[model samples]
Target: MTEFEHMLVNSFNTYIEENGIRAISYRLKQHRFTPQFLDVLVDSLNPDLYLGIECKSISVDKGANALYFSQHFTVDKNGIHQIERISNYLNKSGRRGFLAVELRLGTGHGREAYMIPWNELKKKYFDKDLKLTLQEIRSFPEIKREGKNYRVDPMEWERK
Candidate 1:
């Protein structure tokens, strides 16, 4: 993982702790054969919440809306289809499943950071009963740009 990625994971871990959520963040290593596995796996990472997060950081250009770039990293049709297969395997064994994405700012002017719900993945890959609720979850904080790296404070972003 890159330095910025490390910061984002740390921020997420802090968020889980502050919310009193029982969660663990697993940093996935590059696998030559299994590159599709999530970069991070959050297991039971929230209090009464089971979620999986896939994080991406993008550098924004001047005068551009950061959200525009957020959509690029989402689970595409193929990815969603793959997720369904995984979900099915988990569900057949009676396991809960979820997917989320955290979009953080990288560098340049007008750069901003935020989290976007992978609603497409949830709606298409998961059962209606297994869908995640964004209202019940906490939001991540804006990442700070220092030179070429970005930083986020997990405690500051914790839900009230």
Candidate 2:
């Protein structure tokens, strides 16, 4: 994982811990198809916040072609499908889940981090639960470049 991806995982784990979640956990390069390889998993008796998280990072390449959602893992069809599968697993187990993308540019050009509801995903995409519409995720402020590094301020998703 890149520094940005590491930061995202740390930020998420910190948020969960600060918010009083028990059994906060995260993994990298893990197999999500199996129950044992979830990137992040929080087990809570509280229905409101019981969630599993999948984190993805976007890679930027210099080329004549313009940047498109399809070019990024977070916005690609496969990414969506992966999230949907996780969502379905959560729903079936009476829990909630999300696919969290840690964009390199933060909310670049007006994109944001969002907690797409499982129900909406199920309706739009089949029972697979891995696809997501652009409108599903919320955007955050853009990351600012500082020297050789980029900095992203802490952001929060508005409670629904």
Candidate 3:
């Protein structure tokens, strides 16, 4: 797992334990590529609690803005693109999905993290240019990292 994935896994685990969320979540195995190109998976007896998260981290210039979600799209050997595959899986399984993106803004500047909802990403996927400026992403919930853990509250989106 990449450093961000590892940290995200730890974050989710911590949240599950502390918040008493009865869900089993883990970071997916990574060897060149994951089957679904997903970084984290959460399974639960409650349908509302089930989730699949794809983690992305990008290093940008100090003043750089915008997170071109399409820039991360990739076609697998079977000609399936990442967005289509993940979207299909979550829809068929009736699970919530999110994109956990982190923007690394140079040394000592820290990173900006956001947990973007799947529907938001889906809307952008159909667009000619899937680019969301930082100001736009700010409309979504920001993820906070306390120490080494990330504060992600899926319920905040689930109940909506």
The most accurate candidate by lDDT is 3
Task: Give stretches of model 1 more than 4 Å off.
Answer: 18-21, 45-48, 62-111, 121-160
In model 1, how large is the Cα lDDT of residue 34? 53
lDDT of 2 by residue, 85-131 (tens): 56557767775655455333333442223343445544545644443
Per-residue lDDT tens digits for candidate 1, residues 7-53, read 65676576677777777656777866554545555567333334444
- Whole-model alpha-carbon lDDT for candidate 3: 0.76
Question: In model 3, which runs have C-alpha deviations exceeding 4 angstroms?
Answer: 32-34, 62-64, 158-160
* Residue-pair clash count for candidate 3: 0
RMSD of each: 7.4, 6.9, 2.3
Best by TM-score: 3
Query: Model 2 has how many clashing residue pairs?
Result: 13
For candidate 3, the 10 contiguous residues with the lowest summed lDDT are: 28-37
Error of 2 at 127 (Å): 10
Clashing pairs in 3: none
TM-score of predicted structure 2? 0.51
Ranking of predictions according to TM-score: 3, 2, 1
